[model samples]
Target: MSQSLDRALTLLGSLGDGPVSLGQAAASIGVHKSTALRLLRTLEEHGFVHRLSDRRYRLGGRVLSLAQRALQGIDVRQVAAPYLAALHERFGCTVQLAVLEDDEVLYLDELTGRWSTGAGLPDRIGRRAPAAGTAIGRVLLAGLPQDGRAEEELPAELAAVRRRGWAAESSGHLETVTSVAAPVAGSDRRAVAACAVSAPADRVSPAELVRLVPELLCTAEAISLAYGGSPTPRWCENRCGARPVVRASRT
Candidate 1:
């Protein structure tokens, strides 16, 4: 790396501790005050650092914006691929990863089992489904912060999904299909993506999908941990015992 660039990065990293004076910044990067001032001035111009009233400097809001954008661009599909494949292998059902995009469920990845070839699901990658109608989309919605939506106004089924940690839909939009979904959380314990196992109703009944709930939650938790999220909360950890096997309803 260029020596100047290295020094600048080191200086930036050190500022993360707190605002730092010019001498402290120079010492952090093993440079003289003039050299450090030059680096700080360039960083300030780029909105990477902010000079304080006392002439100390700290990380700037632009740094946070950049970090957020980088996190948003991460390819979670690659991280969840192995888990999706294993779920497909175990259940002989189609497995998918999805996120809420533009009020729709956008599929990022899928592992289709033979039984799901004609299941009539949105099995293709990049396919989008109404977020309130699909199992995975409901799970994503239930897992999200309220934003502007009120909890009391949520559909009862979606409310249940929020409490229990997963959602299952039978014959929603496509009457021949059944799908069970759970949220894959991020470091903040918010759903970053959703994981679902879908299949033809004849191949996997709603009861069968309900039975897969525990394993599905486990799979989601595994992916969440790998994706730097907190583990499933105790309430969500109860899994099979949390709710009886009920027929999945279109929400």
Candidate 2:
């Protein structure tokens, strides 16, 4: 590696521990204060570091923002696969992981329930669908910024999803299908993805689907926790209450 580039990276890594004085940074990177100042100045210009009132340097806001974005971009399918598979195993319903991208729901991964031959499911991995029209999409959109939305201005269906902490949808054009979805949040408490269970209505009736809310929520919350977020506040208060969740074992 070029000496300058190596020194620059070393300086940034040191700042991760905490704020560092100019002399401290120089010593950590085996460079002079002048060199450290130049490195810090360059990083500052790019929003990678910020100088404190005490003349110490610390990681800047850009680092946090970038880190959050990286977490959001993780292959959530891998993180949530076992949990989604568990739902598929227990309920015999199609389970999928979806994220919001380009104002749409993009499926990341899915498990076809054992009961079906995978004939009627419209959703497939990597497919995109309108965000507001699907159960998984509504759950994700509901978790997004409301932007000071007035009660009357917000669609009642979306408002209900936000308040209810989940969403459901039914499709009948081809075959009657029912879906229930809940949010998979990040450390920031924003829904980065949704976990959903879908099946034909004839087999899993709407009322039966409603009854599966507990399991759907449990699966979603487990995925959220595994993804480094806490369980939903309402669920934790009511059904969870500081109790530890046991995830499906991975062999």
* Index of the highest-TM-score prediction: 2
lDDT at residue 102 of model 1 (Cα atoms): 74
Q: Which whole-number lDDT from 0 to 100 does residue 10 have in model 1?
A: 88
Worst 10 residues of 2 by lDDT: 242-251
Off by over 4 Å in 2: 1-73, 150-153, 172-175, 233-251
lDDT of 2 by residue, 131-217 (tens): 887899989988887677764566788888977889987673325778889998776788989998888877888788888888888
TM-score for candidate 2, residues paired by index: 0.62
Clashes per candidate, residues 3 or more apart or on different chains: 0, 0
Local distance difference test values of all predictions, in order: 0.80, 0.80
User: Which ranges in model 1 have alpha carbons more than 4 Å from their true place?
Assistant: 1-73, 118-122, 147-154, 233-251
Cα error, residue 190 of model 1, in Å, equals 1.0
Instruction: Write down the TM-score of every candidate.
Output: 0.61, 0.62
Candidate 1 residue-wise lDDT at 165: 90
Model 1, C-alpha of 50: deviation from truth (Å): 50
**TM value for model 1:** 0.61
